[model samples]
Target chain A: MKKLSLAEHSVRELNSALHDPQAMDGGTEWYVSDPDGRHALACGLNDELQVTIDGHAGYYCAGMNQHATVVVNGTVGVGVAENMMSGLVRVRGNASQSAGATGHGGLLVIEGNASARCGISMKGIDIVVGGDVGHMSAFMGQAGRLVVCGDAGEAFGDSIYEARLYVRGQVESLGADCIEKPMRDEHREELRGLLAHAGMDFDPSEFRRYGSARELYNFHVDNAGIEQGDSHE
Target chain B: MCGIVGLYLKDPSLEPRLGELFEPMLLAMADRGPDSAGFAIYGDEVPSDQLKFTLQSAEPGYDWEGLVTAMERDLGGQLDWFRNATAVVIKTDSGEERVREWLAGNAPAVSLMSVGHSIEILKGVGHPRLVADRFSLSGMQGSHIIGHTRMATESAVSMEGSHPFTTGLDLCLVHNGSLSNHNRLRLELERQGMTFETENDSEVAAAYLTWKLREGETLTQALESAIQDLDGFYTFTIGTRDGFAVLRDPIACKPAVLAETDAYVAMASEYRALARLPGISGARVWEPEPGRVYVWENAQQASEETGT
Candidate 1:
């Protein structure tokens, strides 16, 4: 067990200390204080360490993480746990835009709302937001599971591909190529596991599943007007 | 990349220190926008019967004195003036159309930054710090303020290209991202008799909002309509005499953060800009949801609203 105050050491110093395998010889449990919404804190930790951030943090706080379990007690700014390969990152408070953006592997959970672009371009990550997830979430997602306990914003999961989206509340609008799918036995079982891992108590049967329609995966030249946005291609 | 910061104080005790609190928030995003920067502060309310006009000139050494004297003589009205670095605030008991027409017909060399009872806009090219210092922004006072640092993704890097564009009577808008269909929207707005001040994409948005308000749309309705009407990546923070608001495009690619305490509500491009605010640690901070209109109005004005 260890304790480091961000007031005494810069975020870089604390991260470097966490990165050094020898420096963490006493134990893998470290507590960080006075984060005060600074960027890149507790990022890129690979070992099976437990990192507890005492306060708010800024962009990419637990980015590119693997194996480590990081907890933020307060709100987090943009791109929290961005591009994580594997790990568990938890925010006890709300998360800003693009939470867990483009992460390949990991589980990121927010106890409060997540703003726009939550889980965007996620290759393989399970994201659970206790509150609403904002618009354009899961945009162009390749593969993953995004579970929302509250409303999902406009154009949720636009231009999607092979990712699963589950929402318990209303969805403002679904993006192109993303369509609501029936939550079957397999999806319920998988969602049950995800909710359990995130320590959320919601019933899997309460949610509805959404995923790619697979219509745009192999576009036929004959099918015109598929790209229907105002922008000219 | 661009940076936007807004401060709306619910606690009157903090009004006098608006500039000192807002200076760092603007400069923190210096890297986000290197081309130009600007801000609109709601301060120095004129007499209720009077109109205030913030006037500026392209030439630094332009004879503001001679022009003011001549205008006073010609308009046959007493005009009190306060000169800051970026522009001059002129308070006069004059009609809005008459003043604008007078300025247009007489003082073509002078440009109007804003025309309201209590707003002053100051902006210029360079670092936010330099711009703030040049205008002595840290010494001003107001109920609310909104600022922008531009990266010049579209228009040329001139003062007109800078943000916190003022279009309506006392309203101003600062943007974070570029609009994709501004050309078409601009044309449509121009045909409706809304004039433009610059080729900047953001100006079109400002004009659009002003036009909507003129057409009897409430501020909330105008912002909601923006999400449907405008196409592009954008997050707009609009400032009015008694209110301030935040809105984003449906697919909110632009970044914005908000924090609120008993004393104030603050918004910025990132949390770091808001980190230094007083009593922020205990404030309720959250990311503003996309396609939602978040507005903070003066209590008196808010209570005056008749219906939803």
Candidate 2:
């Protein structure tokens, strides 16, 4: 595995040098150093590359990526893997807002808490946050799977379209049009698979599922009775 | 795809710090819209009651100077100075709308916009430094400023299309997202005898809000009306002479994030954009509710002054 240290180079230089396939012989590994907490360290990559940042990073660290498996050993800034088409991004520490935003396809796993608007407007990304998520998580989410192991803040999944939210811990409340659905046998298996993908050991049965009931999507005068939704037992 | 930023403060204590905080925020958004940038800084003068008109005209051949001189003679103000290719800061002893009307009649060819305690606008095409140099942005002392960098997707690439556009006295708008119902609104405003300079949706929004506000409606009412009336993806950071307001479309098609500290209130299209500004470490940041409009007045202004 080849190791590429990003400490010495600017983001633009590092990206330009890494864009060529010949420079990266099969399956390259880069160990970034002296990161000094720079933003957009490894953004806009589509190569089959394995890049790791040694320290914390600023916003959109691996945004709009494809066919890359990027890892941040420390905290990550906002929009991690934003609009990523495919591949994987793992953050060992907390992530900021709009993580995996508008991603068409990808597996984003954050080991720590995520800030507000996490996975917002997410299209087809599968995000697994190990810790609590801030308010408005998955707001206006179109299509994706967001699994939160810890507590979720208020207004989760507001105006959400088709994304599925699975929370193993407490949820403050669900946003408009979002409802808690029973974790039936099929959902349990699905959760188990997603958890395994993120290398999580949590039991699937312990988690609850939340989704849009499709009730508020089509507005009705009588629908006023359906205010907010909760998923705690 | 560049950045836009604004600052409005009533406390004179924070006035000097406005440029210091705003410069970095504008730098952060360089990647979003790097083409051209400018800012309209508004300031309150000590014991002052004067209407200031900062007008930017097209290239010199358009006869804007003659019109400005006539309007200045008519409105009873002196032309402070002319800078670069466009900006002319004028001071008038007359009322705000009176100056506006005089400028409208005399400078029919010039696209006039304003910001601050009275009204001022600074804009040009190119990088921030390029536009800043053209307008001498750093020297303007104001209580607040609203700025924009153009990506030119929906609007023509010209000085008139730049942001911080004014609809009436002391009102300006800097927008990040596109307005869906801009065409309909523009036609409606034009029918009401309002002139539009550019095809950009943001201009229509500026005109719409200004028209609504001038008609005795509050900022909140104009925003609520925008939510009910405006269509498509948009997020606007609007600054008036008195305060600033932010509004997102009901669906929130565009992105906008806000952070508020006890000392200051800041907002931007992205969190990364705001991170570049000072005093963000302890600030509590969050996305505004979709379909909701949030208005933040100058920290020193009363709640009633917000006109929300």
Candidate 3:
């Protein structure tokens, strides 16, 4: 096990050491203490290493991970696990905005509430929140799945595309072109697997699925005519 | 982008260390806004019968004592004054309107930063750390304080463009986002006889709040109207004589984190600002909801209220 204290080491030194093959080959397990809400800790990891942050982190913690698993014992700031290609990042406490934003592939589990724009613009990430999510949770999400075990804030998924959303609690409102869909047996099975993997005990049958209505995939001719008329005027 | 930080002590025992605890929070946001910085401290309030005014001058070695002597001669009262860098704080029994009229006529080079019993605002065009040090912010003793670090998105990087703008007596505001409809609102507010000191959008916000309060709206009511009347992205931390309040726009594109312990309630643009506070590890931390008003007041008894 490798131990790192953020109090004594800069984030650059810690990230550089994590990136070095010689330094990482000695141990796959890493411990980071006293993160003190510093930004961009343990980012851009490609190897299959297990890293744990013992305290709260600042923005973009563990971002762009390819094959590593990172866990934060406390809350995280904005854009945690943003644009990750693969691997897992779990947060034991609440998360600020845009968690798992624009990620291509990853499994990000937040055991506490996630604020606005969780899974925003995500491509293939799977996010499971143990608590409520703020407004615009999955705004413009191109593809992937977001599971919320607690209540969701306003505009659950705004202008979404192809992404599936499962919530076990009440949704304040849904965004444009997003509607609640039927919960099929396959979806239940998928939720079951995700919940089991994330170590959540909730039953899959209690969740409802939401997805895009596909109405915004193309521009309407009526709107084009209206635009032409307005331009002529 | 800009950064806003506020600390309101619920436990009166922490009042003496208010500036010491808030300095790091403001410093942590240096990267967010490197152009200019300011802070408003609610401390050492004068008696209710008197008022305190914070004034600043850009000229080097400005005659603050001479200005105080002139004010004393005109207002017919002894004015106690102190200086911090280029700024001077004066306590007087004169009327606010009379003092303004006197300053406008006699002190053309000086600018009124704030006028209240408790609030004293100090801001300048420089890094936040330097501004904090210049004002001896870490040594300030207060019940609450709000600070802003400006990146100069909608306004120039001048002393007048900096934040912690005074809204009314014992009230100041620091903002973290730009206002889009400030020009129109400024016109409307000017028509209502509200004066403005800068072209900065945040000053417009402060003036708007002042107008609302003058029209008999409560602070929460004024902020609720701000959500409708103001157009832009903003996360504002307002420091009042009693305590402080936090509000975010409906879209909430700008980030705001709030943490509360038994001792104090802290709001910062990011968690990094609050991470170093004592008992922060045990604080009940969360994000303030969008378009909601969260106020922590220490009047008579400490109380927190959330309103939408």
Candidate 4:
């Protein structure tokens, strides 16, 4: 395992080394220390490397990852793993807002609570939260699955599409066009697979599913004033 | 975007080093808001008979001593004063209304920054580090401090546009978001007899709180009212004589992180500002919920009804 100290190397230098093909040829495992809540640490990685951050990280930590497995032992600021295409980012502590935002494909596991807008506008990324998620989690999510072992905050899955949500605890409120559906065998199997992947040991039957109501998929003339003339006929 | 940082010392031992600890927190947020900076520090309360006024002048080398002498002679009372760069903190036995009138009439260039028994506000237009250094913020001793670094999205870059606006006696507020309905609200507040020092939306928010408090509402209740009346996104950290409170809009578009240790309670726009605090790794760190008021007061000043 190769060790890097953020106190000695700037974030740019460390990421440059991580991004260099020659420098990464001999090492697949890396350890970083003294993160000290610095922004953009080890971001934009494209290799299949396993990196462990020993301390807290600032905003956009491990963002835009392609094939790397990044682990944060401490908390993270806003937008951790934002816009990722593929990879695994695990936050050992709580995460600020917009975690896994707009990720097309990947797996993001937050061992602690995630603040607002977690998995917002996600395309295909799978997110599993061990604790509660704040307001507007998964807002306008397009695809993928989100599992919350703990309670979900206000407006869970607002204006969502295709993305599936499973919550074991209470949801404060549902957003516009979002409603809960019955959990079937297939959903339970999916939840079981996600929980197993996230290293959680909860009963799949204890969760409820939520998704879009499909009412917003088409434009209705009755909702607009253009249909008022037709109503006279 | 702007940055807001606040430190409320729960342990008395950290009082003397408050400024030393807070300077780095403010500097950490310099990138968020580089236009201007300001802070309100609650420290060294005067006797009940005296009131402390924090005054500022646009001129860096204003004649504070002569103004103090003139005020003492005109008000017929002895006044104690301390000067820090362009700002001055004066403790006088005069009434709030009389002192405000005297300053308005006698020293038009000198603006009243705050009026309270313990709060002293200092702000200027410049980089946060330079503003902090000009006011010797690193040497200030206080029980609690609220600071803001402004990027000037809603208003021009000026001293008056800076944050930590005085809400009432020993009460101040620092905001991290914009208010949409400030113009209409400002006019309404003016009709109701509330005066404003700037066209900044944040000042309207401060005045709105001052109005609510004047109408017999507690700080929490006033913030609860703000959730209904105020429009737009915001994460506000308000400093009171006893402690400080934090509130965010229901949508919570603005970011706010809160960490509490046995020694202090710290709130900032981001977690990086709170990273350098002592024992922060073990502190109970969490994000303040949307539209909820979170207040932390000094243990000695905390009453039964104000228990968190």
lDDT of 2 by residue, A84-131 (tens): 999999998778678898988989999988877889998989999998
TM-score of 1: 0.88
How well does model 3 score by local distance difference test?
A: 0.90
Residue-wise C-alpha lDDT for candidate 3, range A1-233, written one tens digit per residue: 99999999999999998888875677799999999899999999988999999999999999999899999999999999999999999999999999999999979999999999999998989999999998898999888889999999988889998899999999999999999999999999999999998889999999999999878844354555455447664
User: In candidate 2, residue B122 scores what lDDT?
Assistant: 75
C-alpha DockQ of every model: 0.62, 0.13, 0.70, 0.63
Assign candidate 2 its CAPRI class: incorrect
Ranking by DockQ: 3, 4, 1, 2
Question: Of the pair 2 and 3, which is ahead by TM-score?
Answer: 3
Flag regions of model 3 displaced more than 4 Å. A218-233, B299-308
Q: What do the candidate models score in CA lDDT, each in turn? A: 0.87, 0.74, 0.90, 0.90
* After superposition, candidate 4 runs with Cα above 4 Å error: A218-233, B300-308
Candidate with top DockQ is 3
Query: What TM-score should be assigned to candidate 3?
Result: 0.94
Q: Write the per-residue lDDT of candidate 4 for residues A122-228, one digit (tens) a residue.
A: 99999999999998999999999999999998889999988999999999899988999999999999999999999989999999999998788443445655554
Q: State TM-scores per candidate.
A: 0.88, 0.69, 0.94, 0.94
Of 2 and 4, the candidate ahead on lDDT is: 4
lDDT of 4 by residue, B38-123 (tens): 99999899999999999999987788889999999999886899888888889999999999999989999898999998999999
